[model samples]
Target: MFKEVLQQLGVKQNQSSAYHPQSQGALERFHQTLKSLLRAYCVELKGDWEEGLPWLMLAAREVVQDSLGFSPNQLVFGHKVRGPLALLHDGLKEVSDPPQGLLQYVEGFRRRLFLAGQMAKENLLNKQKKMKRLFDRNTESRVFCPGDQVLALLPLPTSPFCAKFLGPYTVVRQVSEQNYLISTPERKRHSQLCHVNLLKPFYSRFSESEKAPAAVAIASSVTEMAEDVKVPEDGILQPRLNNSETLKKLDEFVKHLPFKQRDELSSLISDFPMLFSDSPSRTNVIEHDIDVGDAKPIRQHFYRVSLEKQRHLESEIKYMIENNIAKPSFSSWASPCLLVGKPDGTYRFCTDYRKLNNITKPDSFPLPRMEDCVDAVGSALYVSKFDLLKGYWQVPLTTRAQEIASFITPSGLYSYSVMSFG
Candidate 1:
């Protein structure tokens, strides 16, 4: 029934020979690694491997393969999946800012899947060539042509005491570099595809006059013994942070807290390192858009600026373009730019959008009063205030709004890739 289902699904089943475990290169390597892991766990913990199986599997997924250039978990999840140990080292530095919205996650998943598939296909092709080289290097080479007779070691595990190596089968064909199809005349249905390791060439001891026509002819190729099994790599089971380093770092982190509450607060923050950030995060939780609503293009001429301000505006424009906050525009709408000086001696490149604002249709929906908002949050156990950083720029503008939000400058006409302050 399973075979029929597979056939209907356009899948071919390729089964290896029974009880001869050689030349299954990738599969054998995985099994060897799993066994090594289980054995080590048993030795260290003095317990059965069943309790540690889940952790062992997760460890395997976290290991990066040289051929794939990614861990199995990263290829599957399409994001950084840090185990607990990662927090000790990675959190001490910086957390990458990637998780902003659902769209980024979806795109990353698709990209990782595509890269993994391409990498796996290339790796398989190269592995075949590498295996052929390794096989040819350290062993005697033997090739069996068609029409050769062979004695195959076909084991019957159900009846262990029985003489299982009873095959005197004729060679059908060579399926691959080290695989073959062999069958006997009496039992044609018992034909099996086998590795070259399971076969041996048959020899005849009779003279020409006394010889019978029924001697076995075995065709064995020595190449089926695959490359040597690789030992599992040594790695830290669990990372440890020395007391001196932890205390020094912890002291710096909790220095501002009250002396009595430092220990408790430090523990709380340390327990959840992912929730804290050293700097303001630019998040895209709210997608703000400008709605001009069929207003005519407001084309204002460029404003005059001093040569010094012009140079600053040019540098600012270059920076915004490089960082993807703004882009060059060919829109029909534009407004004059302004240079507002900051108290810290730097000038802010501002846009004058009075004409654009005058033409735009207003949304006049009434907002809830402050008293009503405060009433709605009555009896709350906790209240937290978050001040968004570069809040206007964090939200993305709609495509149509972007054209309407364009501004004129000494350099050229440009549009905001993100929402911009007027």
Candidate 2:
């Protein structure tokens, strides 16, 4: 049925033998990227990987392939996708509407795709040749007889201390050129046939008197078995600053600050001593007012919590109270808090404001366009960028707004004194 479907599409299926993932080069490469992206997202979001799937797909298509010199999206569309940067630079003009007439558009698109395919194919061939040259540079070639002793490297657990390449397993027979069937000591067939790259010739100088485990003759490092893992010519690894070194640099930087600026910075530290705490800054609070107007207060019950998370939530509430960021409340409005994992491996306390936002009137104030802001900096001799620390919490909220933003917790009901992240 699969072959029939391919025939219908005027394409012939080229099937290779199973169990050799390296043969499907493109798919294997994509799988590597997919795994890496998913792992990163899962780590950052604490297993909320589903939320990152769309981003993963977008990132994959936008990334330029090393061999093709073009992103998957670009090759298919015959142009790069208009991302945020592009849209910011050129406004709506960055993504113009397609040609009106369907037939004419199809012909144009077809021509563009054909040209792109030709270019991609040529580029891929050149890249393959270059890669092959580099690969052969340090690769040691060795042929084995039918009964030769060899060790086959197999996939193992992903631990730094775990052995990556294992086996003093015997070579069963030569399946094809540079390919061999391997087996155990009892002559049982191995899991799969291995390529020449996976097999290292096992040389025995002494008489066959020594008996060792399969992992005994394994390579010390990946570089010993693979040509790609080469050390730098300088042989010196880059120096990473220790904690003390980092502190010393910061102290040195502080020493260079102007007297007036130092005084101003010191004033902020003195005024907002509690700002160093995890809770909101007490200096200037921004109360979030739910202008329910005539609508009734929307109160939500506290959600079920895990023991570990409940403890964290309690600790976070205490931290906020100690810093004067939050206080006990009897407000009619209430919301739930979600514990999200931050990149730093700490949990960020987030409130679910969806219920409130749904009934609230949308703010229509337009933000300045990125293009205009960037253009305003034209031909400047020197430019400076400043990031406000805890900018949202710096704005104080009204007393009424605080009550409207109350949330229920395991310990008790509480409300923010300053603006909170939702």
Candidate 3:
């Protein structure tokens, strides 16, 4: 059936020799890992594995591979998949203005991909060299030259043992380290590529007793080649918090402040760095409550989300739970959430509260206008501006408001413990 489909689609089907999965060892290893993940996720139950396969794939893609030192997603996409936690961490980074057009964006993406792929390739090569050295340890290399007689391990047609060393075939040439090309019958072409492990020295009965293991001259050379690939062991680099670096940047920022207030503000920031933390801060001073004023609760089903979007949503939900910003809820009011894409390629999580908003009672209290604030501040000696990080999150939510702001996703229903944008 597959062959017919391939033929119909004009696709050529090139397959490797049967029972030789080692030809594509990397693919086989991937299959093994994927199966292990699926089996573990099932918790010993066998059926319905496909249901969790997408999530398992996302998990695997996000994980850093030992050989490459990078997650597959990062190597391919030039960045790690971002959610709420990643978005918050991104704030700590100094980002430049993004490219202006499609061509510029493509150029930027191309540069990133090239750099990431080159680094990944270098890391993979380093790991391969280390593994090769470890594998060659204590193992002898059988170096063969052209015209050497050697017994090649071959599969038997019918015997107690499935295979036997049947050849005293002449060596065609040396390929690399322990691998060689062998002269074989036309029908035996497929098995002619032999490793040192599969070939043994062919000796006459008289010389069998006196012959030494393959040649010491070339064997030491192979070992030396293996050792030549040794790289210096790298130290584990732990990420240290650089308060000094933060303060240095802060000092640069405060240089723009008024001469008299600069020192006092700098001292305050140095003393209480926690006030400007990247993480959200909440206050007990104000607990906001949403009043529907006798209107019916709004319960809307979640919108359909793509697998990629769902993966991000799942990550955002996990972050919210860990930070105590949101929790599982059984609220009667349920609103759907949307992931709005930002210009910088990140997403903004928002709850669809239009239905709830229509029923919400509006506050009628009057407040001073911006003109009045400017007029009042005109008489002051100094004017300063304050900006809060995650301003909406700084305010707490009332218990009743939490239930009223519940939103649903594929994972389940959750409600915010603080104010959230719609």
Indicate the TM-score of model 3. Answer: 0.38
Q: TM per model?
A: 0.39, 0.39, 0.38
Query: How far is 13's C-alpha from truth in model 1 (Å)?
Result: 5.5
Candidate 1: tens digits of C-alpha lDDT, residues 57-124? 87777787665567777777765577644555477877766556788778877887888778866876
Query: Model 3, range 1-422, lDDT digits (tens) per residue?
Result: 98899999999965544334555667899999999989897986665899888877887887889888888888878877764334555788857556489887788778888988998899999988997798779888578899999998767756535778877788988876657788876443643777777889898675754576565552222222253343223433334334556666665556657877988877777788788665677898879999888888888999999999999899888978887889999999999998998665667788899999888988989998999999999999999998666588778899999999999998899999999878
The residue-by-residue lDDT of candidate 2 on 168-236, one tens digit each, is: 777778888867877754333344577787778776776555554445554333323345345535554
Error of 2 at 212 (Å): 21
Ranking by TM-score: 1, 2, 3
Model 3 steric clash pairs: none
Q: List runs of model 2 lying over 4 Å from the truth.
A: 1-47, 74-103, 155-169, 185-192, 207-422
For candidate 2, what is the lDDT? 0.73
What candidate 1 gets wrong by more than 4 Å, as runs, is: 1-14, 84-101, 138-147, 156-193, 210-422
